[model samples]
Target: MYDCIEAIKQRKLKKIEGETFLVSEKHILKARNGDEYVGLKLKDKTGIIDAKIWNNLLHLKDRFEAGDFVKIKGESNYYNDNWQVIIKDLERLDEKEVDKSAFLPSTKRDINKLQEELLGLIDSVKHTGLKKVLEEVFLKDDFLERFSKAPAAKTMHHAYVGGLIEHTVSVGKIASELAKDYDGVDRDLLVSCALLHDIGKVYELDATTFNYTTEGKLIGHIIIGYTIVQNVIERLNVLSQEKKLNLLHCILAHHGEYEYGSPKKPKTREAVLINMIDMMDSRMQPVLDAKIDDSTGWSEMIKIIGKSIYAPKKAPKELL
Candidate 1:
């Protein structure tokens, strides 16, 4: 067993020596006095910590990259309510020497249960062409395996292992229920889109580390997922041009705004529903996981959502 990041606290353990932390982020910053220092974000299975290298920086500066495992001589401290490490000496560790599992965070939910639910949704698509397209799409190559394990984003919501599959299945179930109440909505198409709206994330993110690749940064998961869907439609010849176009439109417009990277706005009922569900899933997740602050009765401000969420003092009387 390894020492967990959450266990090393400034108010508790106080100091540790010669600990290994994965280098998730690395950069150089110029100080006010014209001195340069290395800035880093170190991570482990529990969480991440801001770290700094202030001594003998030049000799070890080029030895490591963002993804490498580095052993460090450091002292941990709490500063402004956050933990950061001041590294005294460090050396890059080889991939084989480091235990990769220690650094990756995993979803707590059961993966098998999630996949079973997803397969059920895939079966629920009533459109013959769309069903066939989806079957051929998932069954081909090793796409299913990769999709089962990918994260929904590099950071922010659902960044841990198996997050993509969990989010997809959970949202698909919700969208399926929501579509049943609306007359014009196509539940089958909406469910299919819900299942696949973020499939591109499998290709967009680094499979093991959950970081964006160069292609992921440049092309983004939306276009990459769109391209994947377009290729499936071309080779399988399963759907009519209109169905294909609408499906592609849902994927492209799911982001809901031009500024947010959607190429077009949702035009069809199914597309709109898909957008709503995707947004609902991505936004709700972080808030649900946000920790409560006892003093202020609010969670720490979430930069992505731009506000701290308030934690209610007591459970509802209805629930009680």
Candidate 2:
């Protein structure tokens, strides 16, 4: 297969192996030579790269649009500290032939194991009514299936299949551990809030294309989650006025600030803790998903991250 960077250097070539990627952006222009060229921002799960088509041999502009996947034959080259590809050959690909996993970045963590651990934490909750309510929502056959497969966000942070669960579990674990250090924070409540804060994402995102739904775009996940939790609280016939209000507050304030999408700022200690943990988990995802190749070492200088990470160097045998 043509690795992305390798394609930019082999100009005047007929074909090269490389994965198909979505054209996130396209700019077609006329070069000084009077030949038509297309500038493209191509992206896959690993990351995005700049690509340019200078030859007039192909009608790529007519065939592909933004968000459509295209297999490209190109040579890799550097331009102003960035890697780019010079297109040599290209073809639009069928949906069935394209692996969705290859198109979306994912957490390096094992999803199934993380999910099971999260469920076990849910089971450990000592509060009878809270445990029952959580079980009712999480154990629903349809919701469980969809939640297990959904993406947490459209493009930010955890945006891949099973990403919702990974992020929730991470936040839940952090909140649970922090509860041990503080007396005001209820471990069960904090963990439950973290796990369910983004549960609405199952409805917020379209599973097939991994894009936001109309409701997701219009209402947002926080409101959707609050609605679901309120419905569950009403259906369960449990939870006192104080407990119910506190739970809702956590969901509403998990985004931390109004500007960040939280309708209400965190009020309760549990809500504050949940918000902090959620932010911590979300920020760590980009670093965890960064690509490192055998030759490239740690690819710390992600344009999105704005910093470079160095791989851990090997130690001398004497140290061992």
Candidate 3:
């Protein structure tokens, strides 16, 4: 079986096997010979590469769709400075043969450690009502299992298993630290908001395949989170009028702006703080994911970074 990186280098040309990755583009085209060609963005844990079928083959289109695991045989070549594969054969593989963990990109942080740290912050909240609400929701048997395994996004930042917990914990830590320096922001409220801002993601994405559901696409995480939080508050019957309004406002405004998916602008100081912290974590994901080995000066093309160039400042010769 050929791995993704080896296939890209053309070192394993005889037979290549790996899972098919459906990126943004999946379409059919007519080749120069007037035959229909199928294109694919095949990927595995290491990375992705461009691939194409030279001619229409038997039941090829129906057999494999984007996000499906398949064993492929292809010869590799270079095209316009990027690796391309000419697929000669393909077959769908059993779910057991394909490890889902190997396909999804994951956060560099530890999920368990992050969860513990976040819980510590939650326990420190001075407000009894807010703390109890957060603990009741997160510490439950059923919610904990799903929250710890869910993806933060369908394709954006932290779009892997256990990503939701990682992102929420990271943002919570940052928001907590920021609260110490700023006045008029309740530290407990901010911390609770950070921990719960993306809770809707657990419902938004399908845990089995880590893809968006129809409800996620239509209502979005913001509205879904609001609904979930409101229901929990009603059930608990412990939050004060002011606390309920403040917490709800934070959830609604965590996305920052209506154009950014937030239904309302941040009305409370804690909500504003959570919005900023959330933005920082989301934007930094691509930068962290694009890192290469220390020995290699050249890294993969960061599609998100685009044409804008950033040069790391040169260190002194002694330091090197």
Candidate 4:
């Protein structure tokens, strides 16, 4: 049923009817003629498309919010080299009416296997107090369940089910390898902070919508993660004051710069390493996943990196 979205992109269909899509975002705007319109980012498992409702905005605007599943009638059109839908009619559907998974994008990797890798990384920690903190933070079933399912972000890289753990494991592996390469690096602290860095995203983003929660808009993931880690440290009271501060500092400064929402800048070697690795993973993901422009063999311009990624098609290998 949702496959038509792909067909729209492939130019196999020009109009859509009786199709249901998830509203990932919604915006109300005015045209030059001063008529209000509803703009939306619609998604199904196939992919996401932009949609606009230029008529009857007042009636349709309030019918659904971002994250609601909606049935829609629209025509597919291309403008500025992108495929989008011009919606004519729309109605919100109850949650029970649709398969939730049909609209949510998910990681291709085995989530269970990724969780196992995270647990394995935690097991490799040699610091007694840090190891305890990792176990207390991640080993709990409730937290594990949420962390395993939550997306890494709303629209940025790894923004899908199981994205948080996928990103975490990636950063953890990078930090682990870097620790081995660099002298005087605290592998325990670097790896621990890497795994814990974005843990707050589980709460920051709604489980189903992947939208920012009130707390996320106000406190953000860095501070939320810092507080979560701080509470665990206080309860345990096993780490030395120095280590505790350093651990929390790493979380608070992981974004690296104040302009980037980091409460503190990376002051220690471990914190610097965490920041770089985190940036590396975050920046690279979108480039890797970008939809390449067929004619240019380059990806659509990525706002985060301020450039398009060169991704020419590769010839298929001969199968023996």
Candidate 5:
């Protein structure tokens, strides 16, 4: 078993047989000859690499799936300037046979520290009704464990483990300060909304293999989160009708527009602010994390963010 894929070498020409995560796989046919093969992507904690199965395509197609723990028998080779695996045999691994930590990428942030900060923010809310609701959402022992390990997205910003809590704590802190600058903003609602905006994401993204679950693909996090909030309100019966309506509106409309999956547009001042805060954090984090400079001091155009990002080059020491 390899601790990291980056340590593997193409020149060595060795067989790699151990636990590798199945990032994706597909059936493809050759154009002229009309022969079939399975194209696949495999990952470890370090990185992912392309792979292919040339034989037994029909037999292997249903044996595993995306986000599965696969025990592979393959040889590493260089192809198209990258390392690819030519798999000879493969088998799906049961949960008992695999270590869950080896196949996933996690956030570098300290999990316990982030949880403490998140709880502190939840405790700081002065409004009794809102505070109680936040507690019910965040205080559950099981939910905290999952939230602290959940990814914010499958591929985009904050995709690693523990990303949800990292993002939530950051947005809560910033939203708290941002709310102070505006007049007539409900601080409690804004801060709580900031904390709860992506609640459903914990369920939306599968942490083990960083893929979408059935609920994630069917309903998405926005609607899923809105429904959860509605249920909590109904059971608790704490907040007034107006406060409940506004809180639900922020969660439903946080995406800002229908095209982006928000069922409603942000109407109230807090809703608009919540949307802005969410957008800024989601956009800025990915840009800051990117290291590809394209030799021009600008990152390659990331389609998801809508524009290329800038990072200033370090001048030579002579200039300094």
Candidate 6:
């Protein structure tokens, strides 16, 4: 049996042998001297760690692909202030030889509770047409099951089993709470959009493998979700044209900006609210999940936020 990835500490040049990991990403790159090396992101339930194979790139290149389970012998080293493995040997493992559950990460929250909260949020929508459409889309097939299991993202916020529902419920609660304080805000529309914004991720990410599907990579979650919700709206013929467009717009613009992959910038109040809530949650999750550095009183640099976070070991007594 292999030890968990989290067992390796930062700055510790520890030796690891006969350990297995799921290759989440792989890259082949050239050094300044024109030598090639392999870069990888390896994961196994506890956490993910960066790794590199500095030599024999050509011989090891064909041994495995991203998403495959591989057995490795390596030594751990601190690079860029993060723990990483310098791989010496690697071999791909047969699926039958490994327990898939050991390699997949899962949410710590209760899946059933999150599912129930999401269903309650959907039921809270007073708009008859919107409620019917949601029911038709989520309750008709195996979608609810898949959605409950799907990760909200590949590596960003909520990238684990049951992550979709957890994020949806959290977003829904935030939207509803904020709607109550803001006059002229359509609470129903805002809440509905929050609950359904990332629904396409159910199909976009492979729930088990945690990799983007062909359609997910080509079309993306926003367009995929827009199409999914739009189809339901059209098929039911229950919503007014204006309401239908507003709902779809919220999903299309939740990414907030065009450069952020949102095809449409948020035009309506509800769209703007969803976009803000989505961005807030996505940014906060990584900081909240990171392990603080004991020496620097800071977190490793978060690529999404573009800086390291300060989380000192000792807090002010007053605050504590």
**Colliding pairs, model 2:** 2-17, 7-74, 7-75, 7-76, 8-75, 8-76, 9-75, 9-76, 10-75, 300-309
Best by TM-score: 6
Cα deviation of 207, candidate 3, in Å? 2.7
- Per-prediction tally of clashes: 0, 10, 0, 0, 0, 0
Query: Taking the tens digit of each residue's C-alpha lDDT, what string does model 2 give over 6-66?
Result: 3332232324466577666678788898887898877666555678988754666777766
- Identify the superior model by TM-score, candidate 2 or candidate 6: 6
**Candidate 1 local lDDT, residue 308:** 74
TM of each candidate vs. truth: 0.88, 0.78, 0.81, 0.92, 0.79, 0.94
lDDT of 4 at 79: 74
Off by over 4 Å in 1: 1-3, 8-13, 77-82, 292-298, 310-320
- Per-residue CA lDDT of candidate 3, range 208-280, in tens? 5555788888888888888888988999988998999999999999989988888899978998889889988
Clashing pairs in 6: none
TM-score of 4: 0.92
Number of the top lDDT candidate? 4
lDDT of 4 by residue, 129-205 (tens): 99999999998769998899999988777888888999999999999999999999999999999999999998899
Which residue window of length 10 is worst by lDDT in model 1? 1-10
RMSD of 2: 4.8
**Where does the lowest 10-residue lDDT sum fall in candidate 6?**
4-13
**Model 1, global lDDT:** 0.80
Rank all candidate structures by their TM-score, best first, as comma-separated numbers: 6, 4, 1, 3, 5, 2
Cα lDDT computed for each candidate against the true fold? 0.80, 0.76, 0.74, 0.87, 0.79, 0.86
Better model by TM-score: candidate 4 vs candidate 5: 4
Worst 10 residues of 3 by lDDT: 304-313
Q: Give the C-alpha miss distance for residue 145 in model 3, angstroms.
A: 1.6
